[model samples]
Target: MVGVPVVLGVRRSAPVPVPGAPDAGAALVDGYGRVHRDLRISLTDRCSLRCTYCMPEQGNEWLARSSILTTDEIVRVAEVAAAAGITTFRLTGGEPLLRADIADVVSRLARITGPGGPVQVAMTTNGIRLPDLLPGLIAAGLARLNISIDTLDRDRFHRLTRRDRLDEVRAGIAAAAASGLRPLKLNAVAMRGINDDELCDLVDYAVTHDAELRFIEQMPLDAGHTWDRDAMVTREEILATLAGRWDLTPVPGRHGAPAERFLLDGGPATVGVIASVTAPFCGDCDRLRLTADGQLRNCLFSTSEYDLLPTLRGTDSRTVDAVLRACVRGKLPGHAINDPSFLQPARGMNAIGG
Candidate 1:
């Protein structure tokens, strides 16, 4: 998704102590008492498919190869984050699997340890390349996978992504499941007049394939800035559509998870909705984003980003830790979608590390 600027708000809750590190317990704790534990690292800003919602079809600017963080730099920053109570490292990208040494990156990150234990590594990908990359990623200690498969129809998929690799994505999904990537998630962007009609079919596909399905509310992250609120398929509409077809019971105890899960009444099938637009979850969010160029974002919608590449290259680990702590201290309470003054962020989703 694209970055959205958050409106500042007064602190409302008592400061929550970090679990293990008492001395530097506040490293990942923001002003509002939200403790960040998950970090999303964007591996690259280049993707094979020019998805209409994520990037412009033509004249898209690609990041310079020299500007992107190297595998060593990524691991160094992740190590500092791990020590500061961040345990989960989710590798994202314009398309992460696009990186030639992505498995090396995963292996290096998997070696990092925090107060909890060894850090858990996961990835979010377009899945067109998963069939070839899945085995290596799993072998390198990747714990989970979130594959974006927006539509089941081949023609519709091509229409949205401008790519005709839906068959490859399907095979990739099967390979991931067969390889035992537990909690494999399929992310779908719910857009009106497009794939909204396939909600049930998508859920059925997930159930049949033994994967979890999640429908994300389309945000104003398109490269062309053509997103309209009226054109979005809201969370309410998604739930109503599913409720009419299946018996769904809310699955509780989802503290920092972005998706609100539901259990399909008749079987082991379950589906989730990431209601980022209609029902914002910023208050319970515990994520920090690292762009491909080494900028750290406290929130997905944060306008401000702290540059970590210089410190990673020049300074010691202590300085990197300090930079991380300072970034967390300044995190906003929420991404101000409800505020009248809200503005779309300058960077699109591909640049922001969705």
Candidate 2:
């Protein structure tokens, strides 16, 4: 009999299951009964960007180096999450690329299987330093890449990041695309006056390079207290503006990604809009997040979290599995998309794994 090909970083032995381990099917169930398809891991709670919405203020306390999960610890958690039913795992961070050993983490997660049993391992980066890491990351079993390039103007890029690396970021993106990273997603945050003028160019750049571009609504997350509805570039407005230029054909059906995807005519690449602010898709949110410090967040907007690292580290693997199972069972049906009376979270977007 043939055995499954061993992935380099996975445990040679399977996680010890408890006597009453729930059927793997139960692990995949979503609030709407849609199978959970995505899992995002916050590799770190620190970032170099002072992007107004993500880290709005001056001084902040970050996780100590010791508190952050080690690569091995993270791999174990990935195994548990994968065993439970999450098929897609994407590494996020204050900037996941900031972590020195991010490629190691990627190498490990690429070994796991989802409910259907083979998973897609990906990462979201700010692209500030992708040039140094892109090629090695691809070699480490990374299946896809999403690089956040909020603006194209060099001066505007400096204003947004308080630094200058537009040239490096652009180079990194090109290298990643050339390296055959499928669905090379370019993410931009739409702020009312900040960099909105460059939306067309941002989208056009992606098209010219054979990459996919997505514009995400600025949301109320950790750095959300600085949020103002008046400053929003709603999906309707973005679509209306983009539609005037190109005749678009909507990608049919709910493809389950957070963004409402589309393909543009006379364009080299596709564009997608994530309307989390104007038209939130909370009811269909079937993902769970693990912060850099090992806390599992049920909702992206949630301020409360359960510490999975301590529980997983101090307890036996079987007991840890039970705790993980409880975390999933306790998953909220969906985030509060329609609720207006929400308070600004104490944690910032960088802290929340956005």
Candidate 3:
């Protein structure tokens, strides 16, 4: 209730019986036997920066304020999801820190105890606002941080985001570290001929700051839909580039993680690569997504979403749980980005909660 606007009153419902009696109360398993325990909830579709790879520089339409989920509504859905076996909750957004009551939201969500134990709460932030918000967020039970840093060069940062906030972002990263946000992760979208030349520099930045770095392959989620496969920096290329500077070895136990982590010999530093386009780890994916407007997405590239706002507002928790389960039941085996039939979702990365 801190930052979210009050809308309709919620009607409480009894606990809904879990679907698939055989796997009842277990992880939300899809038809392909992938048990989902991680949930990414979008806080809002609005952002402060207009990164070219994420959104267009102009003519953007945000979701109606009334349509976005209220704090209580998000908590209700999270309760149902927690009961249904979700144990990891990640808050995302065009920029999650944009929410005025994000700290309050984190506090509410931290109370959800699933079968495994207390749910782990994490966030993927742009980091420009961390200097101001990190303390409250940590106090509110935010367990981890994933900061986005595409480049360290001030001019290139300006060109990429159309914003001159790189210095603020760096300050935020330092603030996050000083605040004891352990295992801090920096995510950089790898694009051919763009920041590809700065891979080493980015790694050095991460190492200097005691943060883990990951390079994610450019996906087709740009607002312009101008993603060119030929212009993408592949996982192989990233690894080779890093290998040239340091001896890299794969780390084990990467089953459910999107990033394939590798250790740099003779140092505590490590790097990860998320080859979503080239490697496709859909088989090991254990994540689900909920858009800001209460639409449930089984995959990042899902063409369709299940609206849960109406149900959350009008019905009981049981019905809401049923809808959540049904959405998981419809999860695709893979994003199918490599398939010739793949089509980009209408919503851009910001709208989709990446």
Candidate 4:
């Protein structure tokens, strides 16, 4: 994870190709005609953690520095996405902090100039290196942070991820809060036998730290493909487990964070459930993923992709806009996280920048 300096911060209003003028395609137009507001850009395909739900079971070779996107190239892609009406720029990766010049990249994105559009920039990381990086990120215009912490048990953490940076992740959370990461979010995947008993404990921890803790379903993304109904700790069960211990007040959302949030005790700390399996909210979904390897994935379930790097490096602004628009038009309404007919892909979450 210590491979590159990250370029953080993205400007949403930078001049970019207009919609369908010449090269602008259907990317600006969604199924419901709402312009794309959020863009997820993967910075690198390298990661240090080998979480069971993410990386390969045996582990794979990490990407070299040369193969990852450059600062200018990443900004160009963000500019095109902003031109396509994307307002939220999330720097994601196999691990975003691994990319060199990430801070520079973030700064460049923040200065992009487009009329009447101000973008919010953020990053999602494994939190292995946030302690030393949060200050630089905030100084460069990072708006918020999302730290992925799956469980609290140290041994289970070791079993799930081959590393033992749990303490580092905690330190990162504290450092991020002190460094202006307001309302930090902690994304957790609740495994059936792994950490399901810690549901109430997780809520308590969230309340204690004033963090938004979200319990996500165990996805069928890893190459193992061993997910079953037994492995899935449904949303209803999660809610019941938490509610039985503490009173919950359902929290309403605006754009829908893909998680149904609820205040644990009518306070700032909230507990959310991302029930992609028990209850899929694909209809109101609005998300797109760009892999670190330059592939544009419309849906996490589909292995298919629309390559954007070729056009990104050679084409004019119009051509880039057209390709992005085409990819957006091709966005699926929702993903079948529960349908039995949908055989999930073999790639793990890390492969696609979860």
lDDT of 4: 0.72
In each prediction, how many residue pairs overlap at the backbone (N, C-alpha, C within less than 3 A)? 1, 3, 0, 28
lDDT of 4 by residue, 117-157 (tens): 66778889988888887778788888878888888788888
The candidate 3 region of ten consecutive residues with least summed lDDT is: 4-13
Which is the leading candidate under lDDT?
3
In TM-score terms, candidate 1 sits at: 0.92
lDDT of each: 0.85, 0.75, 0.87, 0.72
Instruction: Tell me the TM-score of each prediction against the true structure.
Output: 0.92, 0.88, 0.92, 0.87
Please give the distance, in angstroms, between residue 314's alpha carbon in candidate 1 and its true position after superposition: 1.8
Q: Flag regions of model 3 displaced more than 4 Å.
A: 1-24, 315-318
Q: For residues 1-354, what per-residue lDDT tens digits would candidate 3 score against the true structure?
A: 333111121121211223452244556777767778899999999988899889988899999998999999899989888988898899999999999999999999998898778998999999988988888888889999999999999999999999999999999899988887888999999877779999999999998889999999999999899999999999999999999999998898987899999999856789999988888777777899999999999989989999898797885454777788889887766776876778899999999997
**Model 1 residue pairs with clashes:** 4-301
Better of 2 and 4 by lDDT: 2
Runs in model 1 deviating more than 4 A are 1-27, 315-318
Over the stretch 90-197, how does candidate 1's per-residue lDDT look in tens digits? 999899999999999999999898988999999999888888878888889999999999999999989998989999889988888788779889999998999989
